[model samples]
Target: MWLRVGSYPDRELAMEMASKLRNAGVRVEVKEYVEWDLTEKYLLKGKLGELEEYEEAQEWKRYADIIRELIRNGMEVEAFEREFLKRAMPEEFEIVEKARSDEITDDELVDAVDAMMKLSLLLSSVYGFLKANGIEVGEYIQGNLPEDPEIIIELDDWAEGCEKVYYLDFVPSYEISVDVLSAIRGGAEIHGMEGAVVDAASRVLMNLIAGIDETNDIEELKNYAVGVIEDSKEFDADVYVDAEEVFEIMLRSLEKAGVIRISGKKVKFRR
Candidate 1:
């Protein structure tokens, strides 16, 4: 008999349940069971059965679709039981659908994508700034690059409850290119500003983008970035970050500090 081995609130969960049922000597099939208990996070009322013949299986599948529509529209177990109690199809069909509820349309996917793009662009700009400041922003990435540099990072969008968040996992032993490093290093070297934009951008990216989530004031983070670099005397991920992100942040900071006016990505330090 073709039997629904499991029912779930979501396709993934249903698949998992069906897999386990298959392993347990049962003919498992995944079915989307809706009309869940809002508080319990599981499907509430649904009918499932075993089909004995090919014709019967097709008929069951067709009937299940009608039931699916009912559940999706919010059916209650008590109401369904009261109605179906008079006519019993089978004992297993009396069983309630249960599984972790999930949304088919997760908005977190979009939010995560946007967040990552913003972060990547910010990182690239900051890295650029670091290079302008005489700091070797790409040194770490160049050193730690994986077997493949182009595929350096994997972007993941995840749901944190109802909200979607994005994160990046750098490829094994690889670093993201902070492309703005060269420009920022130049700015620092020409102006002799003591690590200059690189210093400022590094600290900001470390705190904001990197996992080092230290709460730092603008002045402190700027000093931290420069100090870490000057002391280490090499490209360091522990304190250093994508120089490009730092650059964008520094432009904003400098504008805020009245040290320069950043217009259309061109930050002109006031002479």
Candidate 2:
């Protein structure tokens, strides 16, 4: 997917110019990209840290910090341990042991790529299913509808049953479990294939993406992104998220703050 910078009447001429630039050793490669706005206090940091160190530091450092901060703030020992320390310490040890060395195995890298591909495909299928069923989904940050798009985060919040904080909305969009996807890929027969599996997967997905919309300041977005980075560090899996993708969904908040304007993948200061 080529990122179109500007459009001219002559498409051939543009391609020719691009080719000439590449021939002139400009290191040109074309790829598609998405733009989005973020909210919360973490998404605006604009950097994805080194994955190895990120993994090691987040589990131990963040766990210790949260615990220490809580205690320093005069929180009760039992409550602090139960709420944060106990949960963080075990996982910290597990992640530190698993990610102690910097080198990643080839199989682990391949698994990460495969998992991403499966998720992409599943999102595409879900988007199609929802659109066919007459549930309209608008792009959350861009404030527009995308054509032939996958992974449509809703622009508005809606409640499903008693849950009031279902910000990401879609109908007939089955939130399948990672296990089901893994099972199917592993050639295992999905038992109770119809309603049971679908409902379970949907429940899992809902829980995973469930959060209330907070169209607050960019500071909040930065904090939220930092939390995600720290959380990723605690896990055993390898996740290499790009800096832009991390904050794109939160760009709307920046725009809402009257600081900038976003056009496609390009952003600029508001006049």
Candidate 3:
């Protein structure tokens, strides 16, 4: 009979422990165990309601309410001019009011709202990516959005009276680096050499592993992995990777490596 020696929330750490035990000539089988009870589940449900997307939606609604109140008080752009710039522009205040009153008919307003929504989602996703990569926002740099996928960040205090600007273009490329190849190989090793697929799914596997700790929701993780691959500049342009295929391969590979175990809708890391 195997005895439970330890439990870990971190999948990578659990895998490391399993590897060490196996190397010491001790039999080890990493298994997933759920310890969440009713109270924990209730807490998690409450936390889910406070997610960033929900917060952002609430913020927009508040802005709309404020704009409507300003219109009622006979103050339009003047109110925004005195206050700090919110996510929406001053001119968008009128648009918001018009939208709320069902008076919005201009295609331009529709396009503006569409663009704003897209930009908001893009910024949120990029922030998460930067956080995962251990990059701190407002540390030494400030981001300026001139357009979609083309962000220019100004780095402060680089040298004496010298300002450095870094341009981050979230566009896919055909070039693949050696580091990416190594990551792909590492992912493949989880399920043996023959389990590897040299397509787009293989590329996504690398990012999926990196973002494993970001979320326990497999569907969300799969979407994030796909989005990362789509925005990456290191993807091979010639290869086609399916999102569904990537999710399937990712789950199988991680499970085979004893890094994770899927039970119903929950994915628990081996401990």
Candidate 4:
């Protein structure tokens, strides 16, 4: 038989309680004992000595509700680990205060969780698009979220079917270290031979199509694009364009004015 020091209806609260208790010289064993719903569950996260099968209690729903309320209000899950709650409940102390200088704040943890949830939904939307295009999508490895909260998505079976090289990172309206960008582009240039070829081909075609004089030879266009790309590589290619809104407006205007029209497999442009 084990002594029950505290009982939490959710795993988050239970884990915090166990951690705090252990810090304060208490021996406790924590485990999830019941599943109530996809989001809410009763966890038997306190006690010492014995591990036994436990069923959901009548008051489990009430405890779960309390935990959920705190979470919804943007409170850190560790807020439950406070000393007052430990002493007032009698069921749960002088908390062993650990240095929190390196620890992330409760607010930051909440924000990170919120960001990940939104990112998951966005990824689901993209999965739907891929499935619609007859691509088979499978479960992806979801590693621990980075501290900075950036989503890195790698798609398979799109266009190049995993044979193409593409590297693009969006920092979400913020500036990132130029050193990081340099490293990324350098790595890209090394492993992106296929991408370079593709880019060169597209640039050459655009140049020839938009030229004042008509050029019908594919070989000549390829040579020109290669020369231009190689020549331009030595110059600073880093450019910051703050005209995203302006570009959006231009795109809408072009669509409305029919300056560029897209019809299945064909794009018509006004000369």
Candidate 5:
């Protein structure tokens, strides 16, 4: 997948940023977009596939595309069923064939199909919930079951009837520059500030880093940073004197440190 890392009105600047990141061992790509005869913008994107979950998503998408194509090619239901059985495990094929031949009546088949459709809808809802909660479907498939009994019951009911289930696990993924992480962890001076100020800035920076994955909008990140600072002030008012000002300063420092790039209304992480 290609993730937008930076945007610039000037093509040269965008390419320059891409080159810099590429030289630093990060995969980068630059593309140009033109407005309706008004303006042109350059976008810098980074390729992401380092995670097993990402790879799984890609493979799942490919498989879905293949199935879609097969359907579009006018495959009959019997042909499709044969194809499905060809791909099914031996035990699964036996169970499904037996159900079709002897175990399932006409009304029971209708009920089973209805339940399957309901289960599909339920899985879609679950997928959206997991994504919103920062979960990966591939990770969930690898033995990360939900803790809630109701959720487990729903899943088990569906899986018992259908003989298959898809799931995802919650795991927040964020990439931060090594230098920035080291500075934050080692308590290094940030733009000549130390102690509480550094701690506050580090906390805000980490939040911003995590937030950027969700949104690259500069204002959104700034607002999120201010929220973090405000939450911290509830504990130690002296640590953060001005949330907005502190966020601005930290953003500039991050830009100066080559950990991030700001262009117009967008902020992009280098990593």
Candidate 6:
């Protein structure tokens, strides 16, 4: 379970909270959110944890909100509390949907619970929906989400009786490793057969698209992706971009909007 604490002007500011939370023994993930209303850029991050119970999770979330409110707004804690509550409740709802894992992925992503409970359904509904409508979702992804859990409401094919439910890690395939991608983009090259950076990049993209699930990474996937490329018709004839090349191209594309930068394999994003 993750508990979002407060917004910061930069990672440095967020790190201040992270430092405190670390001292208090909490896990943290610093995420950069793209802000639409602000002229100056900022970031929002929450301390994260994987507690066994929801109550423990909520307890820490409350603690984080109090402490971060002190840090971000000083005496205006009341206002901070109000905003946090507004954000926290819905965020918790979002988190609950995401709690489900991918051993349960499918086209609809929602499991049908009942007609009135359309929101709680996942997996079977998506499969049934696409198949019936003659619509197609990707093999691995099947579909993408606006955020995690990626809920799709109203399936009258929308079967009112059955609702779609996503209840796990609900990860999407094709999420690139910002770290490696950045290194490659920062002009760090890797040697892979006679392939160019594009080839490596394509492999990386495939892994992301597949959204390989594991507590620890299965390195063999890299080899498998590479083998597929090697067996491809353009095996050695093209100046195939390696993973790094793809990273460079992708990051550069992102940079056109002032959202990112690559330095020595590090990715710093601004929005």
- Per-candidate TM vs. native? 0.17, 0.17, 0.24, 0.20, 0.26, 0.16
Q: What lDDT tens digits, residue by residue, belong to model 1 across residues 53-110?
A: 2232343343333333433444354453333322323322222221223322223322
Cα lDDT of model 4 by residue, 129-179, tens digit: 234333343332112211222112233333221234343332221111111
What TM-score would you give candidate 4 relative to the actual structure? 0.20
Q: Model 2's lDDT to the true fold?
A: 0.34
User: Which runs in model 3 stand beyond 4 Å of their true positions?
Assistant: 1-199, 228-241
For each candidate, the alpha-carbon lDDT, in order, equals 0.32, 0.34, 0.42, 0.33, 0.45, 0.35
* Model 3 global lDDT (CA atoms, 0 to 1): 0.42
Q: Write the per-residue lDDT of candidate 6 for residues 1-271, one digit (tens) a residue.
A: 1223344433433444444434333344566655333122221112234331223234434434433443332334244333434354444334333423222221112221121122223234434333443334442212221111211233223222344443333321111112333333344332222113333554554443343332113333233233334444334553333343233444454455455544554444453
- Lowest-sum lDDT 10-residue window in model 3: 39-48
Q: Cα miss at 260, model 4 (Å)?
A: 83
RMSD (CA, angstroms), candidate 2? 28.7
Using TM-score as the measure, name the better of candidate 1 and candidate 3: 3
Candidate 5 regions with alpha-carbon error over 4 angstroms: 1-182, 185-194, 228-242
Candidate 5, which ten residues in sequence have the lowest lDDT sum? 147-156
Task: State in Å the error of residue 194, model 1.
Answer: 25
Worst 10 residues of 6 by lDDT: 107-116
lDDT of candidate 2 over 39-84, digit per residue (tens): 3221111111322233322343343344334444354433543455
- Model 5: per-residue Cα lDDT over 1-271, one tens digit each: 1224334443433444444444444445566654322222222111212222332234333333333444444555456445533342234445444544564432343343344334334345444434433334451121222222111122223312233434433322222122334445454432212123434545667777788889998887776665434544224454434356567766776788787898888889886
Off by over 4 Å in 4: 1-21, 24-102, 138-271
Question: Which pairs, if any, clash in model 3?
Answer: none
Better of 1 and 5 by TM-score: 5
